[model samples]
Target chain A: MSDQPTPTFISLDDAAAMTEGTRVTFIPGLQALYSEALKNVCFVKGISLTRALHPPMGIDKETGEDRQARLFELTSQTSLPTMFHDDERPRNVWIEQLALAERVGSPSAPALIPDDVAQRVEMFGLCAVILGEDGMVWNMRIMNDGPLSRKYGYNKTASAAAPAKVAEVIALIDARLKTQAENGSAYLVGDAVSAADIYWATMSMCVTATPPDIMPVTAQNQGMLKFFASNAKVPAIAEVLTPRIEEHQHYILKTYCETPAVLGGDPL
Target chain B: MSDQPTPTFISLDDAAAMTEGTRVTFIPGLQALYSEALKNVCFVKGISLTRALHPPMGIDKETGEDRQARLFELTSQTSLPTMFHDDERPRNVWIEQLALAERVGSPSAPALIPDDVAQRVEMFGLCAVILGEDGMVWNMRIMNDGPLSRKYGYNKTASAAAPAKVAEVIALIDARLKTQAENGSAYLVGDAVSAADIYWATMSMCVTATPPDIMPVTAQNQGMLKFFASNAKVPAIAEVLTPRIEEHQHYILKTYCETPAVLGGDPL
Candidate 1:
């Protein structure tokens, strides 16, 4: 119900052409969890970001080689959620982008990293565990990717271990949320919302199926979401993904993030 | 095998009572991948470490409460491969422990972290992907833990997704190793053996079953190894666990680490 203007999605050419201000190139479809998390951080911090769609890295038909996007020239990696601010080095890593958002955002906004040393350490550690290299979403990605790849008859096979790992991560988050609730805090790390909360709220899309009313996606993306949800319904994941976790995602999106997520030009 | 002295495993009480140099408490039996990695780091660095068996945290019969070990009080965590050096804070995290080894280790030893900034980043990033929270072994651990738990009729259920994740990690390692080999480097990162090499070499135990002759474990552990190996033989894992990966483990243990491994009371 917030009246925030819909984020305008621009072409990769326009994004690369503009050498001023903060520009973020993100993949706009179902696999937009990382992009969404970064956008939500900017949203909470009131940091203006020029949104651009990541160019597809498809094979070059004539050359018989892989086509490299202009984005790859800017950042060696060909991944979404890459941020470029002013003349600074492009930030492809999630933590670095979060740090950038914190650095340039409005001073009046809630701090993503807590002031207290202990809370800061806890926040960083939890964020790393949730969003870092081998963190929760990373594992969930493996779990989901394996089945998706196999279903398409790709050479890739699924890991029998990913679901349990996903479950373990869910259990950890649920337990943390429960403890925070018990301590009279609505957020993940401390009293106010932090990067951990945003990361969890958006990344939960990897596991939980968000209805169209809350997060509208194209029909193709809807099928993808269904696939992810079905894969996530294993006993290991099911046993720990408590209702509270889902509610927290809803609360974070409704209160802090742009509701009815304006991803990939979905109508407001 | 090198004539290096067998590492004497001390009792938990003796280890706790020691007020001395570097002391490492590790789970002795089958679940010793973490311990093995830490121990190998010390071995490569030629740092003397007093080995201690971590006290089990089983439930008490009369109180029906989970018994807390002295280790838990020191580190606030109930896991293996906890390192204590002098009066410094106990290190429960893998990266922290690696840093400790790098700090107190011999200068003559092959540096685990690369000297060049780019190589260092690659090494750390790869190490994280392998040993970090959701890295390779972590996913494999989930893969292995699921079936083991289910087999025992524990409250846990297996994730249908873990095996593919395990395979993906294996493919990553295999590809890295292959690239390194093709580039004429014997190790994972650069020309020298770095922490990345050691981590991949030891952590591969989670996926590849080491024979009793190479690394002697208890008879009970042998059974557990069998269970792990059987679970790890899925199509996903099988497709990627190339011979090169297995050979690297043997080479590291034989050339760098003390072998046959002097774990628990198993005579060398």
Candidate 2:
């Protein structure tokens, strides 16, 4: 770890040079929880990542091409975080990233995926719901758009249905946490920390911001927090973002999330 | 009651002449459940109606104008089942129709809107959910459109969320029914039949087709029944359209809905 307090974010041009080692394409912001979580997983596994820049919603100034288009060329999908590992298949989704973490992790490191088959099934099922097209994040994006913009993008019926859909998933997660509490298990699946817990804790980074040390809270992230906080006005949204859920997320972060890796540009 | 088995559908021109009594503007079809239910209300009230034709999805050949445009001119809205009573204000919505039924119903007829305020509130709330934009019907419409057409109408996120939204409302209705069953009340609200029962029964017309004698099932209606029935493949939709719900709808039609009126036209 460098003595420097701030991490500097590297440009895509700089990142393009590193093809031999672990390379990750990510945007540094509260919204980039999936990317950050993946980075955290790599850190825990003692895998060093050469951080790459991913611009938000526009063309990259240096490249003069759509940043998203470049990202698509790198990884088949546009959404971050995109990972490249020395002549290996590029990993785009969080699940694939988690699998990679487990494969290369140091022998002393704890397994993120459960050893038991039934527990693995349950954990993966919940993760699918969280990451799937019809899952929490997708549904939240639908609800996030303002009513007018939502109508044009989503049909009248879909605009009408978005909130309830988000609520249902939130309720599912909340219920799982409640059950875990009742069973005296602090983690999402079984008694130990798993990818399910990490994924959930990080996914809610915007909704419930982690501490400044683990994930820096910036002005942009503040805006995200407000966006998530506003959802609390909706009763169903409020029900799932309960104290218990927040406590569980914080607990996972405290136990598993180590000192933030210095991925170079001024600590996001 | 007349022994005539054949049901007569009225023409627009003939129905137009009678302004002295209850006047209903409706098209004869399974889709015209709202209008049909209102007509049934009038029949039970012993209030004679001059049934008029409302053309489906196109211009009226006789008027040389859009049938829906004409309806909008008359009622400020194009949705079917518009009603005009003498010089009284036109009643377009189910709520207005229910109010009209209560005001003009015969002394011998059972009340549709419950007298109790709490019961009325509960009934209306449920009705709003069923009929509102986020309700089962609207969500069903969203899901009903083909995937290609849906892209233009609704965005990806909204499209994905539609099924769950429909499911939530279905679950709500199912839960209410379960509670009612536990309490030994066949009706949705209090013991006796109310607008809630009639409205739900009518709304679920496609889900559970009415008997041949009461609501003649046309080819389109049969298709609609199939559409609704197919939704049973989804567990949430299947839960609402349960055997108990079907039985309840049939009970309402048999007990409350009476003889088909002779408004003078070929059977629809």
Candidate 3:
């Protein structure tokens, strides 16, 4: 690899524009995991089929039906986030989610991702919704057609990550953390911040803001903007959150993840 | 028994009707549960406020402002749901929320909303979502407002229950059920379907058909609802659900819940 790394993505859109694939999911293994802002989840889950595909409902190029048919099918399934059937959980999400379980023997274990082999086994029991659309591909594409979803489009197909699912995921994490939170801890997995916490800190960017240089959105996250624009307390949380978020991004996740190729060089 | 059963409602020129009370919440417990349709949540919620208030927003004398404002405040904590805080969550909603958690018992207890508990207690976690608001005398006022809430125009308040959070809730629940579902158990809760299942079932109303009888409107539920109609799927779910839901006349909740007039003789 060259020392300069020949920065690949000039802009966020440039990365999304590289769409060469038929299906795109949240960056594999990099889904977010926060539990605090459950009340403010609206801000995090701004990505969705409706918001992404607001105006135009296209027709599938394949079956030749209203594109919404598949979109709704996938959207409904996804809306409930059936990423994996109880019997057919997508290995991709299940495997990654399982990584969070208490694993034993694995060197990666005890790194806030679980060290208990039993917990690891139970992860198969954990739900990590899927989005594969010979049925769904069209609607996500339509989301890209919108000015809003297009603004944050991703994957080679430049498909818009369904904001609805994103929010649902945050709520899932929040639900997972309610007990943890009832005890009073901002983090998810372990005593400190776990992969779940780090994940939320990272993914919230799709809805909220990240460093201008990183997420590089022209706007601060959407629903958050609408909220804090009117409400006062939320902005206070942002102030405390934004910088610590950077710390987690740098010190925690940065240790594992690479900069998205769509964005630029290797992980920052 | 008095001849009058169906409660009264207040109307607005711009939107749907409201309950006798000025305050209202279109959340799962109150409106969506009874209606079995998410399309008219805003309107149904509006009915609560209308019935409570002497006048509706922009239409009549202002009476329900306090209720509306407080109800808004309770669910307005962070816009993030207390439960299920994943960043991958969806937007348009149905159910499975955690943000507005109601304290039932121990966190390690595994289950939520035990069947033996009273309705308010069973749904206590969700009901607590309203605690943040002022429910003193207004609780009764809210109770009384049901008839007025169901009449003219409401459906615009927009609860914390967004479309995205609904998706995340379903996905998470689906994930939770993976093992059992694989085991051939169809329900999410116990052998039959508990409040948890009922909540999801009620929330799924977001996907149900909102006939005109329930969501009476000036402009209509949507431009072309025939294509979007949920059909028997919506009613079918209602059949398996608790008897609490009243599809036609909302007086069950209005008289029994809001005012104790037994407008629908809900057997409370």
Candidate 4:
């Protein structure tokens, strides 16, 4: 396992007790790609956050539900990676979350969004490919959980088309990475690290297995992850997981992210 | 049929000739919900837009493809309702389009976003229920186009669940509307009209057919729309199309949105 130090995590009760600072609720595991990406954004930007577990991580055993109903009262939805900054309305959408991070980040830190309009558009577009509905991770979910799992309920025709759709997305990522590598740029969008880079680095876990050393997980989770990875490795999908793409994922993770993931679970 | 005057529409060729100011590409048909919503937002904000037809409207009969190809080149995708503001990058996503309207809207125009943080959150949440993924229109699409029509490829399980999913969303909308009406607020979220109100007003077309006078469509399109409406009126769906929801939609259309939709097409 990597020697990276584990980041501190506060319980929901502890996080809720703080009435004055920023608090975030996220799924506390490696497989929670959005959570990991949001956490990385905060880390890179040097934004202080009180992290608390959500859903399964914080479920009430007796009721088999979220321990806290207050989250629902606050955001009116059960989705995670939601942030509450002071008394501001809870930021639930990914784009909103990124905007919030950009706003609250330390002034000394590098900006996650490109200042140039063209580059900013390009960055948001690439991030959408990684995080938007029907993007790469979405297809990956279809492969692992079936299309209906998320309530999308596409027809058998679309269900059958998942592999091709995923293959197309992977090819797009591979082509982008190849071009960026040729230009000698380490980041996805422009000269500096952006939300696109961080998103891909974390979201890649859905397709390719992260080394246990880089992102240690519970043994049970590791097995579950392997199942998901295997389910996602259809022939078309396998063809597009190019070396350049994998290299970029690893590069971004090791260089920019918190290794060992700060996930408080036991190592596989 | 509608005593309401038809709005003027510029052809794509005409719109493209103008070299200055703001331009937008949108589908030129009654059934395009997002297009109608975006157009309404601009109309209410008093933002002048050079409207150009997209996709099937501008498709070449010989090749049966988009005549301009420039739209795909500009946005990297074929989806419509994209806006280009004074040499800025094209805004394609719904949220981005709304943000653009907010930015360029008349100085004295009422804000589409509520000034109160809680109301803003509530507004967005309601808007999400109407337009977000797995929201009302999405379910309407499933009812009309089948699950496989889009790239989402859900299984039979989800396909089977669409009616219930749609019913739940409708109930949620009905509940929200009922509460707002009880509070004597004409709008969905706050004291004044907001994006959420306009979004629901336009998006409601998917479930309920608009009067022919107000949104006159070609006879062929009228038949097609009837089919869509019929398909969407499954038992569970019909139960939630409460009278309050219908009245609210008509009220918003007549009071705020441009009558006859400025859709340059022929009357039914």
**Candidate 3 TM-score for chain A:** 0.35
Superposed by TM-score, candidate 2 places the C-alpha of residue B77 at a distance from the truth, in angstroms, of 55
Q: What is the lDDT of residue A6 in candidate 4?
A: 47
Query: What is the DockQ of the complex in model 1?
Result: 0.02
Candidates 1 and 4 compared by lDDT, better number: 1
What residue runs in model 3 are displaced by over 4 Å at the alpha carbon?
A: A1-57, A60-64, A74-82, A87-190, A194-196, A207-243, A255-268, B1-44, B47-257, B261-268
**Top model number, TM-score:** 4
Better of 1 and 2 by lDDT: 1
Error of 2 at B203 (Å): 42
The recovered share of true contacts, given per candidate in order, is 0.00, 0.00, 0.00, 0.00
- Residue-wise C-alpha lDDT for candidate 2, range B98-142, written one tens digit per residue: 667777778888877665433554565566555533355656667
The digit string of per-residue lDDT tens for model 2 on A165-259 reads: 66665667788789888999888889888878877876765455445555544544656666665766666676567888778877777777654
Model 3 chain B poorest ten-residue lDDT run: B129-138
Residue B19 C-alpha lDDT in model 3:
18
Q: Please list the C-alpha lDDT of all candidates, in the order they appear.
A: 0.70, 0.63, 0.29, 0.68
**Which 10 consecutive residues of model 4 chain A have the lowest summed lDDT?**
A144-153
Say which candidate scores most in lDDT. 1
Candidate 4 C-alpha lDDT tens digits along A1-268: 4344544666655665566677787654445777778888888888887877664435687887765465554444445666777655566668768877886889988788775433554566566556755566666666534423444435555567767766776777677777787898887777788878888888877777677666676643676578656854778878878777778888888888777667755544
Give the CAPRI rating of model 1.
Answer: incorrect
